[model samples]
Target: MKTIYYLFGLVVMAVLTLVSCESKPSLQKYFVEKSQSNEFMAFDLGTDIIKAAGSDNLSADQEKALKAVRKLNILIFKSDSTDTNVVHYKEETTKVKSILKNGDYEELMRVGSGKEGASINMLGENDDIDEFVVFLRKDGVFGLIRVLGDEMTPTDVLTIMQLVEKSGVDMAQLQPALNQINGNKG
Candidate 1:
């Protein structure tokens, strides 16, 4: 009886150890506090999807539209990886746009593709913008973050984009993490 109990304890301890050692992968976090308007979003490169949610003023259709994007992963490719690649991910972002009709606000969305990216094109929208957003990883981890308010300026937006380009989660780090979690070698 004593040996059986010891074996059971060892098994429980092993399981707990595995669980604790599991890495918690998160999306690259990009946050800009005390700047820009009210905006919240997450672009999961792993899943090739972009999600933005904010304000009750949005219409049902807009919410549906946000959910409609089943595939947009092509947006996360490296710019210089292939020169012959016709559909360059970096430049492709300019062609992307979405409209959101929240309860009291109309959101015009524009997300960039490459390392340097931008979302929530609110400068031309309401005179006073208030928003907070994040770029979530495919694993549902939070990555880049953006919080904008009345104090956010156009230059601030540009600066934020630059920062994202310089430091957003790169594929180099992500692929290995995914492989480790899924027990597959890339």
Candidate 2:
């Protein structure tokens, strides 16, 4: 009887191991760590964020992007330790419009309202700490991606946006689900 019980336990353990391994998503393959102005941050489909090196600040787009991600892995920058001042403002200029001139991703209609989506711009004029006001889809679906740096550099923001675009997420499918969550009548 003991032999039979031991055999059963071994089989259960093996099955459990296989089940756990299979639960990992295929998107995990895309994660990659890259060097940034802040320190080192990873980017990819599975990676939702890369924290500001030892600082509380995150670029506007980074914060918004993380919210939409179902799974996230963040690498904190370890080198830079300086603190900068964060300024908050609402402005109507596409200051970094040129960064997204390629226009690979098209904008979707807002789920509930037709109003233009809001955007965040964080500036550190005094070399304090950079911050950004982030834009998010109020319907909880999608929004414009924004990332702030010492200045809104063309490459940094574009890099983050491209990573998000390539994540194989079917935004069209996600929109309806998001609208349902928000209880959108429209």
Candidate 3:
């Protein structure tokens, strides 16, 4: 009886240890997992794509910002009241917010209100910015843009934005995806 009890205790301890070793799911992991259901569209771009999109005449600030950016992950979901995934969307958004709240992320900016909301948050130490998360919700559609970088600053993001605006990247290309999310067969 004593030997049997010791074995049972060892099994219980092993189970507890495994449970404690599990790490929290990251934003990227959530995006990838939930996207498999076809409720969201995921776009991932590397540094090379960003570099190629810009002009050769990039300013010093723009160059610095572009170089600092290592990767970009975007997930867009169009609100469909009739779809079952709407529940998942709400749950996933709450999870993301909870994760951010528990971390050292700081709000950089916020715009709009009510049903339309947009915010930018950053995670970093001191002057070195590590990640920039942009959450935008408008007209029943939601979008998340995660910019991962090394030693980035707020000013660097501004410069990169300006470069993107001038690069003639077709903004209309995204309209079809947005329309699909809105249940508009375009």
In terms of lDDT, the best-performing candidate is 3
Please identify model 2 stretches exceeding 4 Å from their true place: 1-46, 49-116, 125-129, 136-154, 169-181, 184-186
Q: Which candidate tops TM-score? A: 3
Please list the C-alpha lDDT of all candidates, in the order they appear: 0.36, 0.36, 0.75
Question: How displaced is residue 19 in candidate 1, in Å?
Answer: 50
Poorest 10 consecutive residues by lDDT, candidate 1 = 26-35
The parts of candidate 3 lying over 4 Å away from their true place are 1-22, 47-54, 83-85, 171-176, 182-186
| Per-model TM-score versus the true fold | 0.24, 0.25, 0.73
Clashes of each: 33, 9, 0
Q: Tens digit of lDDT per residue, candidate 2, span 4-75?
A: 999999999999989888633211221231224222233322332433343245555665444433332322
Write one digit per residue (lDDT tens) for candidate 3, span 13-101: 99999998768766766777867867678777665554335367677777798888888888887757655656766776667677667
How does residue 51 of candidate 2 score in lDDT?
Answer: 34
